[model samples]
Structures are given as C-alpha cells and as structure tokens.
Target chain A: MPMHSPTDTPLFGSWPRAYAVVLGALLLEIAFFYGLMHWFA
Target chain B: MSSLDWWILGGTIALLVLYGLYKSRGKQSFDDYTLAGQSLPWYHVGMSVMATQASAITFLSAPGQGFSDGMRFVQFYFGLPLAMVVLSITFVPIFHRLRVYTAYEFLENRFDGRVRSLTAGLFLLQRALSTGVSIYAPSIILSTILGWNIYWTNLIMGGIVLFYSVSGGTKAISYTHLTQMLIVTVAMFIAGFLTVHKLPTDMGFTDALRVAGKAGRLNLIDTTFDVKSRYNLWSGLIGGFFLQLSYFGTDQSQVGRYLTGETIKQSRIGLLMNGLLKVPMQFLILLVGVLVFVFYQFHESPVFFNKQEVERLNAGPLAGEFQVLNRQHQGLSAQRRAAVLNLQRATAQNNDAAAAAAGDQLDKADEALAKTHAAVSDLVKRNNPAADKNDVNYVFLRFILDYLPHGLIGLLIAMIFISSMGSIAAAYSSLASTTVVDIYRRVWPGSTHNEVVVSRWSTIGWGIFCVVVAQFTNRIGSSLIETVNILGSLFYGVILGIFCVAFYVRSIGGRATFWAAVVAEAVVFVCYYFDLMAFLWFNVVGCLLVVALAWLFTTLQLNLRPVRVADE
Candidate 1:
C-alpha cells in the first residue's frame, strides 16, 4: 500500500496507515495476553 | 514519612504546579482559557488526553484491581483503540471544521438547542460527580498514609487544583497533564521493577508469573460470551467500545483535551497515540499489581490494606476480638507463605503434580485468609456503621508505604496527587466551557457578562460543587476506578445514542432523538438500579435502546404528521 500521499503526509505517513498501526498494535497486544493466559493456564 | 520523603513530595508537587502556571502564562481570552487557543501539537494533546482520563483512582486503584481481580481487568480497555479510530475518522474532523468550543455545540446545528443542552447537561453532571470521586481517591492516600483528617485532605486536594484550574484554564491543564503523565510513567515503571525485586531471591520474573498464574491472577483474556461477566473480551470489545466512544467523542472533558490540538491531524494523531499507548500502559500497571500479589505471597500480607481503619479498629472496644482475628490472619499468612514456597519450588523443579498439589494448598490457605479478612471487615462495620468495607482502593497505597524506599514513596504519592489534579483541572475547565458556551451564552446572547469572568466563576462553582460531592464519597463501596466508570456507564450510552442518531439517522429529528435519549437513559438507570447485567454491557444496551427508540418514534411521527398538517 502507498505509505503516504505526497501532498498531505501526516503521522505514520498517512491517516489510514496511522489507524492501521493502532489497530494492529491492539491485535498484537491481545495476542500476547491470550498467549500468556493459556501458557500460564 | 521520613524527612527525605517529605521534601521529595513537597518539592515535586510545588515544581509541577509552578511549571504549569509558568507554561500557561498570558492567556488572554475565554478561548485561550478553555482550549489553549487550539494551538498545541499532537504530543501535547496526546499526553493531556491520557492524563485527563487517568485520574488518582487509576494510579491508586488499578493495581489494587490487579492485585485482587488479576490481569482480567486490563481487558476493560480493549475497546478503547477502536473508539479512537472512530473518533479520528468522524468526530475530530467535524468538531475541528465546525470550530465549536464544546462538542454539544455541533448538536445544535445537527439537531436543535434542546438536544445540545441535554447532552451538555449530562456531561456536566457525570463529570462533576466523578471529579468529586477523583478528589477522594488521592485524599485517601493522604488520610491513610499521613493520618490526616479525610475532610481536610479532601479540601486540600480539591482546592489546590481549583486555584490553578480557575486561573490557567485549558493551558494550565495541558501543561500539568504533560508533567503528570511523565511522572506517572516513570513512577509506575519503577514501582513495577521494585515489586519484582522485593520478591524472594529464588523467584525469577517467570517464576513469579507461574505462581500468579497458578493462583488465577493471570486470567487476562476470557473469551466467554456471558453478558454478565464484567471483564471478558467480548464485553470489553463491544460494550467498552461504546462507553469509550461516548467518553472521548462526546464528553467535553476529553473533547476539550484534543480540541487543544493545533489542527485536525494533530488531534487525530493525539488520540491515536492514546489508543496505542493506553492498553499497554494499563496492562503494565495491572502487572505491577499482580507482581505485588506475587510479592505478598512471599512476604506477609496485610489483612486489610487500609492501615488507618485497622489502627482505628485496634483502639476500639472490640480490640480483643480484632486481635483474635489478627492472630488468625497471621496463621493463614504463614500457611499461605509455606504453600507458595512449595509451589515455587515445584514449578522450578518442573514437577507438575507437586505444583498442582501446592497450588491447591495455596488456594485453600488464601480462601481462609480472605474469610478472616471479611470477618474483620464486619467487625469494622459493627464498630462504625459508615466505615468503608472495601480495601481494594488502599492495597497499592499500603504497598508503597510499607515496602518502597522513602524517597520513592514520596514520588509515588506525588504522582497520584498530580494525576488527580490533571483530571480535576480538565473536568473543571470542561464544566466551565460547557456552562458558558452551551448554557449561559446561548441562553442570554445579548447579556453584557464578560465571557472570561463568567467562565472563571463557572470554574470556581464547579470546583466547589465537586468538593461537596467528595465529602460523600466515603460511602462508595467499590474500587474507586470502577465506581467512577459505573457512574459514567449510567449516562454515557444514552448520550452516545443521541450522537449516533445525529450522525447516522438523518430522518430522526431532534425531538425524537432527545425524548428517545431521555427514555433510554431511564431504562439504563433502571437496569443499573436493579443490577440487571454487568455494568459494561449497559453501554451497549443503552446505546442500542436509544437508536431503536429514536427510529421507532420517528416512524410514528411520520405516520401521524400528514393528517395534522392537512387539518391545520
């Protein structure tokens, strides 16, 4: 995917990518916690 | 407290307050006072937003939550990232474009004054009451650790912030929040490290986790579909989403935080930063609590974490009975320590059977200890009918005081106090702006009252109001953070529903949406009053109820309108 619009770049290169990073981070954290839960369970 | 600790506490607070006042100097108008002239960069907006949400209750009670309830409570913020995304895509852009001081201002254009006024009113009521609770959370720290009167602590806590908030407005709040979050991050990370360090020599971090996991404190993700379960993943993701969306998207305390952003992109980035950081931050805080749980498994734990209450009960007529319970608590603590040691050894040896046996013994010992604590609590209640039965709020405070080094203890207290000030300042400013922009200015457009003067008075009025509310907060029986959230859940959903109607259901007029919100709010309250379901789900129920009722009422109106028009 295009990382940024050349004329109007913002944080994380673009708005969509920025949002994707946040949502992606949430997924990663949830996965880590889930693994911890089961590993310890 | 030691002299070194006192110096650290006093110096840190004084420095932070002076820094805020310095950074916010020379704000000229009500706009500058309320929105920091909307000139802050994304990082300032981000830190300010985080600080506003994380009140004293967060630092004081979240770890206590982790200590008692386990890692599951971290799930409650699962929906927050999703809420942030929605807000970024929709709410931020519109609020920025409209150039409204309060989020409710948009409602007037979208619907009418009544819808806007009602939403603003709901925000004011919830924010003020919760600000009182926020004040009470730090007051607990002072009253418990310093052995000061609760009333005096409440006043000091409320008044110190009031002075800055009234004078500096959003500019002061933003700078203070930046400092506050920095202190919180550094203090909590150090505390987490110290908690693990305080554990027995043989226990590695993984060993501690294994012991905690065996004790069921690591139940971080419950994928259960049960509606009544409070901290399960499903509710956290769905219900928590609505609650958070309403909170950040519509609640002026939060809206005011981001509205300080220099531009739309800045605001969105700030919120996105919060989304990315909050869950992990909360997880670490709770993990510290769990580690403290691990720490106590090795050392002797407090029967009741509120030392002041325990000392008070000790001096009472039932001192003999309390001593007997104390002896039982010591016995149970010894048994628990032994079982935990065995469990730790078994886990180290990788012997599953021995570990399971030790875990059972540990559970049994801990259960008996919990019962003994309950009996002592009952005695406390009998001695003073108004005593706070829940010690969850004091668990972390007691740990910091009893265990941490002197200077560090002061830093931690200062951290919690600063956090309380940040949120209270934000709430005070938000309340003032909503009062001025939504209620006063709109109500009396031609009045000669200076907006800045009225705004200052409004800030002071809210400060006094919240302080009064703080006086009654001792009767609240739950963990402080949960109490604040539960109070918020009562109104947030219906308010979010109104916004959803305004944003989505274009056919639904203002009157239908307004009345629907009122009726839906009543139903949500009824649900809450009866303990109908887990409080998180009330967010989902209330939001959906308003949407459905508004749509239904709109349909009825359409069906009846033509005949009335023809008659006319």
Candidate 2:
C-alpha cells in the first residue's frame, strides 16, 4: 500500500474536529465530576 | 458458583475460542497474522483497543481502588483523552503510512537498530512485567473461589489465552475482543445497577452517592499541587498525558491494536472513539466501586477483603489476636452502619444539621474501623510474611461472590477472565511480532524463514515468561491496577522522550538519543527508588530528561545535522 498521509475523520468532519470533540468531552467530564462531587458532598 | 454460573463461564470461554478460530480460518502471512491484514474497520479496532487495555487488573483492581481510594484514582486517566488527541494528530498518520509491524520499527527507521532494539526492549520488559502482574489478578479470584493453588491458576490463566492467541493470531485476539468487550460492558453495567438495586428501597443511587460522598468516597477531583501526591489533577493531566502518550504511541501492545485498522482514518477514528468513551467507562466502573462501598455500609463489611489471608490468620496461632480485632471491627462496623442510617434519614428529611452530625459520627466510626483493619493487617503479615497485605484487589470480587446473584456472578467472573484474556493475548501477540519483526528479521536480514511458525513459538515463549512473572507479582505494594501503571511509568516516559526527539528534534542523532535514554532511565529509577515524587511524574520527568539530554549531548558534540529518519 502507498504510504498514508493525514486522513480526514469523516465521522466528526475532520481530524482536528474529532480531537476537539474528544478534548471537549474531557473538559466536560472534568466539569461534570466536579459538579458531581459538590452536589454529593 | 452455581451450575448456571458454571455453564455461563464455560460457555463463554468455549464460544470465545471457537469464535476466534472461526474468524481467523484462512491461512495468514506474517502481515495478516500480526496486523490482521490491516483490513478491520473502526469499531473492531476501537473495541479491540479498549479490550487490550481493560485487563483483569482494570476490572478486579480498579473497582477495588474505587472501594479503598475513592474516585481520586479516576484522575489517573484525565490525561488519556488528550493523549489520544495527540496520537490521532501525529502518531497515527506516520505509523499507518509506514505500515510497520511494531512501533519500535518506526524507531529503527527514525534512528537506527540500536535505538529500535532498546525502545522495543524496554517495552518488552515493562509490558511483560505488567502482563504478569495482571495475570496474577484473576488467579486471585480462582484461588479464592475454588481453593485452588495460585501457581496452578496462574499457569491455567496464561495457558487459556495462549491457546486462543496461538490459534487465531491478531485476528482471533481482536475478534474475541469484540465479544469480550460486549460481555464486559453489559456485566459491569448490570453489576452497578444491582449494587444500587440491592440498597434499601428508600435509598436510591443519589442517596448512595450522598453516603459515599459524606464518607469521602466521592472525591472525584483533587487540584492539589503536591509533588508527592499520586493522583491529584496535575499528575493526572501532565504525568498521565506522558504515560498515555507513550502507552498509545510507543507501546507495541496498543500500537499493534490500532495498526490493524484498514486506513489511517479507521485508526484515528477508532482511537478518538476510545478517547470519547474511556473516561465515562472508567467513571462508571469507579462509581460501581463507590456503590459497593455504600453497600457495605448498610450491610456487613470485611475488615480485610482478602478472605484467604483473613481465614489463614483466623485459623493460625495468631487466631486469638485476630479474634479480638475482628470483634472490635464488628462493633465499629455497627456504629458506622448506624451513623450512615442516621445520615440517610437526615438527608431524606432535609436536615442538614442532623446530617452533619451523623456524618461526623460516621467519620469517627470509620477511623476506629480503619485502626482495627490496620491492626488486623499487621497481624496477618506477622502470621505469614508472604501474605498480601493490601486487600483492595479483593474488595469488588468478594462483593460479587457474596452479594451478586448467581448467574450474573458467573458472567461477571467470566467477564474478568475474558478481560484478562484479551490483554494477555494482545501482549503475547505483540511480544511475538516485536521479537519476530524487529529482532529476528533484522538479525537475520536475508533469511526467508517462515515467520508465522517462529511467531507461534515466540508466543509460547512469552506466555511462559509472563506466567513466571505472575508468580512473583503477589508482593506488589499497591493495588494491581496502580502497580501496572507504576510499572508503565518506570519506562514509558523515557521511551516517549526518544520518540519526541526523533519526531521533532532533527539536530539530534542516534548515538546521543541512545545515551540520553540510558541516562534518563537511570535518573527516573533513582527518582522512583528514593520516592522523589509520585510515580506518574516519572513519565513527564523521564520524557523531558531524554529530550533535554539528547539536545545537550548533541550540542556538546557539535553534531548539528538535522534529525531525519529513513523515510525522509
């Protein structure tokens, strides 16, 4: 097979967008966990 | 385990082995065997990747960690999503393009054979050591449940995975992972649900969380900046990032997983999927652990969860001392249970003052209970020097055996076994591929040996090696999950640093990178040996040290030639 170059992530529009979504989700999880601890505590 | 449980467990294993053999029916070449012909789609790649990392250590030890340490351990994974993002952006394209059999092959292309071998060697060592530790985890389950000797269980655990891996190669391992992950996901979810379901009808999930929170078990985040702290946000973010980066980017066990994807997009998307799901998955698992903790508060709880060790001490010459501590433990547990019930009623009535009072009593009761537990552990150790003192690994397993419904218990045990199988099989395959492609192929440059046969032999050799490693893993100081990460931290940073210099620092050459890595590893060792800082930081420190040392060494030699791997 020919050597691959950077490929688009058609699922999330593009690679950068996919990364954004994952990282964005992480930030959201951190926020959610903080909220969870506070509400439970 | 009931007959139904036995059937579920037996049927699960048989289905897995048969399914793997079925999927990998056709004859395969070295490429097909090691890389599954690089034809798998993103979902297969995604779950396959997930299954490899979700070893028995993850299932048995992580929940146990949740029980003992609370959600603070979840911070250890905060760096994971970011690392996935970084890998998706950088490593995926390069690795997919090069089409190498192992991540270490890229090192060979970028630096030279020595660097490749050294990095691969480190991966082999750490991965083998960690795999052995994980293998020992499920063996604990079998030994506890069946009263079988652990040596036999370890051998059996390692052999079962070897059977599947040798027969199906990477394709079988990945295919089996598809089913293994499905059962694991479902069983764990049901377990969490049942843990909550078993609570008194008046108490719901939120109430359980309240109880756990008041007990300091809902500590989800710690923004502490302490260097010596193990699982604060900073360590998880920075230290975890380096560890995750090295694990996904350099470790052949994981790298080999993504390499099976048909396209770079498949690999990237699959990894991104892992990033998306892993944290939530871990959170759910930890929540189950916290719920198990809550379960014990309302019900009876063990002073030490390792029943085998507890039993031995209770029946030994120290029986008298253990009985006193056990009685003390029972009284403290009753007080704690009463306090939690009061807290529960106070919360239900919206009585903050009463709730606060109850929480205070609960804390005091826990302090007494903890002291009793410590005394018991000390006595257990004194009774038998070889007994495992840290019983966190047994917390979840004991709860399942004692509390979970029977058929589900069988399924969950099967799930842990299968989870262990997925990881061990992947480790075996990676070891074989690395040994065959990086070491064997390179050493005998023009030899047209049938590599598949050699790879099979290599798998057998590694399986035995890891099983031996399992035998020696019982003495690990931390929970098995943390022990695995600690093992990874020891080498992952230096490996990632070498890759960083290769990828981004063109002015450095192979020799400088090599010596720099050697010195960086020694420094990391000293830091870990003397407890200079938490283990997670070892990744960050080792990686930075390699890059810095490589640059310094290169500049000192005045070798200003830009770094270029073979592809360029």
TM-score of 1: 0.96
Error of 1 at B264 (Å): 0.9
How far residue A10's Cα lies from its native spot in candidate 1, in Å, is 3.7
Task: Kindly report the TM-score of the first chain in candidate 2.
Answer: 0.71
Model 2 per-residue lDDT tens digits across residues B248-332: 9999999999999999889888898899999999999998999999999989898888888888987889999898888999999
Give one digit per residue, the lDDT tens place, for model 1 in B1-568. Answer: 7989899999988998888788777746878888889899889999999999998898889999999989899989999999999998888878887789999998888887888899999999999999999999999988987799888999988999999887776887888888789878999999999898888787889988988898889999999799878889999999999999999998999999999998887888899999999999999999999999999987888888888888888999988999999999999999989998898888778999998999899889978987998998888888877778889998999999899999999889888888888898899889999999999988899999789889989999999999999989998878999999999999999989988987777767777787888999999989988988999988888899989988988787744111111111
Worst 10 residues of 2 chain A by lDDT: A1-10
Residue B111, candidate 1: C-alpha displacement in angstroms: 0.7
Ten-residue region with minimum lDDT total, candidate 2 chain B: B558-567
Tell me which residue pairs clash in candidate 1: none
Worst 10 residues of 1 chain B by lDDT: B559-568
Off by over 4 Å in 1: A1-8, B558-568
